[model samples]
Target: MTRNAAFKVALIGASGLLGRAIAKELAGVAGWTLVRTAHSRRDAQSVKLDIRDAAAIGDFIGRESPDAIVVAAAERRPDVCENDPALARALNVDALRFIANAARDRDAWVLSISTDYVFDGSAPPYSPDDPPSPVNAYGRSKLEGERALLESGAKACVLRLPLLYGPVLDWSESAVTSLTPAIVKSSAPLAPAAVMDAWAIRYPTFTPDVAVVIRQMLGRHARGETISGITQWSGDEPMTKFDIAQRIARVLKVDARLVAQRTPADSTPRPRDCHLDSVRLEALGIGRRTPFDSAIASVLARYPEPTQTLKSQ
Candidate 1:
């Protein structure tokens, strides 16, 4: 199905960071109507549906009968998922299967948002074909979700994204507000642990740019394509966590001299690098990846502040 053709589209997780951005993109476009679902009646036109409730999802699909479904919701917090593995599995894996099945039953196209965590992060700038070796529970669950969807024999596209920063619909209750404050507060002179040698590269796309790419991919002719939604930052220079923190400070014009370097032994185990190579998307003429500096500026521009920063004890 093409964008020019009128079709009904259902977007799950419409209240999330990426979901909200996708919803905004869909709103301005023609030939598509946004069918939003929430855990509760958060807004008008939103149906009360939890992804864990497969029966409810099936019922909703039968009722709304959208031509396409975008599964952009997932339990994204790694620590939270580690604490509640069952709940995470129910929502991230099982729920995705249910949505894929429903879309298939209705002969609708499916586009599910995934994450770069599917990889173990041992390799830098992972391509779409890289073997997944997830080290964390959250990563494993998301990998399971991707496997379930692919194995279902449905026409689906799994787009794996990196750390996302974007403007939220409810600014007062947005992920950025909650996370950024903690990030800023935690920004202090690097401690022994803070300088840990752990490393991970993130594409960190702007919400607006990612939303535009998703719209183009779904509304255009890229069905059955498993694309990576990360930008190519130098194609070789992988940014470490310390590097990211330093850059964040620099973009905000804050004193980054105190941002110290540490080893992975001081903190939790994390992937050293997981930057994605978006050659496929670029080849398709979708959109180029936003520069790291440019993306940071965009995020900081949306949220300027003298907020309390979180300090790690």
Candidate 2:
């Protein structure tokens, strides 16, 4: 079970934004077999499993008995988490606990996705060892999940990332890409300008790149090297949502009138800047940061914009 030439892995939350990217990455790997799971959003490729249910998680993990487990399930919306901390804790904290504890029996390596929100944006660049001071419900729940895994005694790695944008079935799938609709709407004649926040700085990392990092880490683990504890991966670009909107407009080749709100207007308090240093993963030679503009273009290409948003040939 420890060192197999090939690996069987279970991917929880396979129907979500990050899960889809990870599923695609695992599909392309040579010697990896994946059992993808879905909850509210069911798909034929994935089995139905509500990760929030502890007994169900135990039963599923016990029956499937995979060599590794990747947890992508989370209530990532800061606003939603702020409004309903209970639901956030249920998925982000409790579900992760069930997973980590279940995996302990099989000694399966557990890789759980975490976020930059764990740190209060004041820090310029946070390291794995940096103490976390989560400012919002979302961050607190995720940090608790990380702690739960650590306490579970299962071989685990908490991979923390920043704002992510990549191939999306819809723009709203990612916080960074969600600005597209408003930016596109602004292109119409005499349309109201699309205003974005210039206050909070975010490093928009690509989901596909994160997926590759997981693959690399799992490959290393399968090769008999134990990859445990906390690690981070993120894009080096530093831009606000307003700046990101402009880039999205540029990719659409549109003359959109976009406005930037210099002040923080979110109901939920946001950290001004929480940049994560990628040195840890970079040292291991396992990470990628596709240029923001180019990556955005690729994502936009996969999902076409409304006719009004497209430029004339």
Q: Model-by-model lDDT, in order?
A: 0.68, 0.88
Residue 167, model 2: Cα distance from true site in angstroms = 0.9
lDDT of 2 at 115: 92
Instruction: Go through the candidates in order and give the C-alpha RMSD of each one to the true structure.
Output: 5.5, 3.7
Q: Quote each prediction's TM-score.
A: 0.81, 0.95
TM-score of 2: 0.95
Off by over 4 Å in 2: 1-5, 302-313
Q: Model 1, range 124-212, lDDT digits (tens) per residue? A: 67888888898788889998998888777666778877777666433333333333443454555662222312244544567777888
- Could you tell me the lDDT of residue 265 within candidate 2? 96
For residues 1-313, what per-residue lDDT tens digits would candidate 2 score against the true structure? Answer: 3544568889999877789889989997888889999887766778899988889999899998888999998999999999999999999999999999899987788999999999998867899999999999999999999999989999999999899887766678889878988898999999999999999999999888999999999888888776889999999999999999998888888898989899989999878898998898898889987999898888887445521121210
